[model samples]
Target: MCSCILLAALKNADEMLKDIISAVDTSGDGKIQYEEFRVFVEAAERQLLQLFRSIDRDKDGRLNKEELQAAFRRAGLSVPKRRLSGFFDEIDLNHDGFITFDEWRDFLLFMPTNHNGSPLEAAFSFYSSIVTVNPEGDSLVSDETLEGLGYFLAGAVSGGVSRTATAPLDRLKVYLLVNTKTSSNVAIAAAKQGRPLVALRNAGGPIVDAIVSLWKAGGLRTFFAGKLLLGWSRVLSGTDSHAGNGLNVVKIMPESAIRFGSYEASKRFLAAYEGHNDPTQISTVSKFIAGGIGGMTAQFCVYPIDTLKFRLQCETVKGGPQGNALLLRTARKMWADGGLRAAYRGLGLGLVGMFPYSAIDIGTFELLKKSYTRAVARYYGIHEDDAQLSNVATAVLGATSGALGATIVYPLNVLRTRLQTQGTAMHPPTYTGIVDVATRTVRNEGVRGLYKGLTPNLLKVAPALSITWVCYENMKSLLKL
Candidate 1:
């Protein structure tokens, strides 16, 4: 297993070098002259400068042994102080006890070609090189380094962007979700408010009436009523899933990172355990199974934050001051009610939903992407893997998978939200368990009740997921991820 992963990593490294060469060989000469090499190095120098500044957290012009050790730790590696000191001694060519920008740049530029060792050592060396590049230094930026930075930034920003952009739809979904029992009454009340739009209610079904009522009662702003509350609640949790609809791209960013990372890690470990090093011989189901496991792993890490965010969205507020503190108050009330357990209500159901949701979402996306890539490759006469799908294909496929996965197991989501918000000061505990929630929802509001807020949910999720995939893919291409 270890040998297999090592071989894979080495193969990846070789491909990476090829990509770097292609990117730097601007003249199409097949061979890079000294001048071409200088241009590539110069471009890399910019990233090295950023890296230097990062390591020099104190804004100092030099990096000490301590700083180098800290950088190693930042790159997900742990190195002994003694080893780092020896490494620094070699890097500090002037015997100056500290590494200057020039020395740092020279070390990276003159990196040893025979540094490859065991996979673990190679991984360690790779990450150390990555985190050591600071803005204050004069190191060169490799295409790979730039690509990595791009993925990190893209994942972080895309989540918040998708969540915040669809905030209005999410707010509507939550409103309908918590008020399903009283949705009709609320629409009637809105009609009684003498808004001219009330006439539309008579022409439509209950869902349409509710929407019209909400519009008449509050106009455009009503759609984004508690955005602040939702954002703050999610932010404070330091986890993702603050979108009020449980689909936060930001949180999913880390979730994705974890999912993919864990999948690879698990694959390597499993192959090692089974004594199978041949990569091509792996089963196709491995990807789907790995994806499902990865999703569950991510869900476990962020489910509590998700629960809190859901409860806050499902809060039954009635004409009180809507301030930022409401989130804190709600959190405190949950703490007072059942301690930590209250915040984790419905976690079981969430995990159950997550398993299949993650499996289908990731598997379907991969299958579609590959199929699209293959078709495009055939049309364009290119390698299948090298084929590029248009933005429309990426968006449509992403939206379809998201909508399908969410719809397939939507009842679990609805039940989870209800369980979290139930028994709160505002919304009393009605259902006893998952079964109870399901039974009561069906008994009280008919089968359709289990799908409350689904309209706005699909509206919000389809585009949000689409945006996430589009942004992620585009960013990956831009960074060459």
Candidate 2:
């Protein structure tokens, strides 16, 4: 028959392919049936068993930790000791501290096989390729490295976009924070200038006055004055630009990366110490502590740049420095004034506020997300693990959490900004220390003074946090974290 001729030609085309097909076609009828396929799978499993026995060097019929490590080495794979231990523990399903032949066979068989190699070879090759060393004998691919990269890229993109989008609000906040002039005074001044519309805009409130003033100084461009340069500088040089617009991706990237990376790392460390294999199973208090630690670490590393950015933002009110050399000039001046101390002026207060703020922000978001997932699962009659929150829900949760954090820390932020701006050419040294700043602010403007610019701050922070969380989660998913 024609079919018989075609089958014969197919079998003759490649010897290796014909052998594979024939191995699975145990019926020897040049066609594979269910019974024949089942027999082939049994044969493959038996071969896996043979491979396992070959690696059981002591002939104890079980693989101890040492033997398992030796097998990987013989396969020309180098794994971290910690990772190997985890692997070993996972395979020792009964917690017996050793892998029996049955366990080994089950693990090997679960791995997807490749046509080019046996199941055992495919599994080993896949594991080996997961973590690799470059020509310089340094680790080039690993879980930690990949996770950090994911955070870094996500942070950079989210920070840049969010900051750019909320730049006007940010500028308004900084302006209101630094300038103590009341809205009434601004309105009266504009009225005297015979600009009725300007006076009306100023009369709307401090937020309106700040917006109008910024607009008059440089039109609409003033809102995003320093952001463009910051973006360009990030692309051209790896260094951050002291742009007051808060769009410095180079600056934000490292801080965001460290914050998220350290948070995950801290959670893992705590989970291990608490005898939990999964970090997500850790307690809420533990999550809060981990988030606080991560926030502190990130704040410490970027505090100086933050101080510089605040100072630069304040400068926009007076139209101080401009162009590429602005950051260097500012740094040099700060160093000349008080050396390293000047650069870290409000760091103490910053840390104090950051701890609780970060703790609540991250912890609340996690708690909400967990509850949301559970509720969704319950409603749909599905497993909790199978439920996922929509992107809009994620953004809303992030915004709510961020707003709460920002509100709690707004007073400290105000004090820090005041302290950083003090002793500059415009605002003379009015406070001697943190206490002095707090005392003067409360003494002069009452309790509400501590919350100066809270409105614009909320406006800026809510969207920024929402955008940040959405982008970060999406990026993590993209990178398969």
Model 1 TM: 0.59
- Residue pairs in collision within model 2: none
Off by over 4 Å in 1: 1-153, 180-204, 208-222, 225-284, 316-318
Estimate candidate 1's alpha-carbon lDDT, on a 0 to 1 scale: 0.63
Question: lDDT winner among the candidates?
Answer: 2
Score every model by TM-score.
Answer: 0.59, 0.68
Q: lDDT of all predictions, in order shown? A: 0.63, 0.71
TM-score of 2: 0.68
User: What would the per-residue lDDT of candidate 1 be over residues 1-481, giving only the tens digit for each residue?
Assistant: 2222322334234544555568668898889889997887886566566677777767789988767666655554444343455557756878878888887666554232245443224434644543343433445565334434554566655555666677777867766665545435444565777764764555335556556755654455445443433444554564322233233443545655565455444554555555663321334466566557767887777676666666665553444323345556667777876887877788899889887887777667777887788788999897554477788988899899888888888888888888888865445656678998888788888877878778889998899878877877776565434
Candidate 2 Cα deviation (angstroms), residue 235: 11
Q: On residues 1-481, what C-alpha lDDT tens digit does candidate 2 reach at each position?
A: 2222222344233443455576777678899899887776687678778777877898989988877767765654444455567566655668888888776655444343444654445655433442354333455566556556666676667666677777777767877777654334577788999988888976657776677887766666567654543555542463333344333554566777778877888887888888744577789999999889888988999888777766666555445555445656666777876888987888899999898898988888999999999999999997665587778999999999999999999999899888887766435555789999999888877787888889989988899899888887777666655
The candidate maximizing TM-score is 2
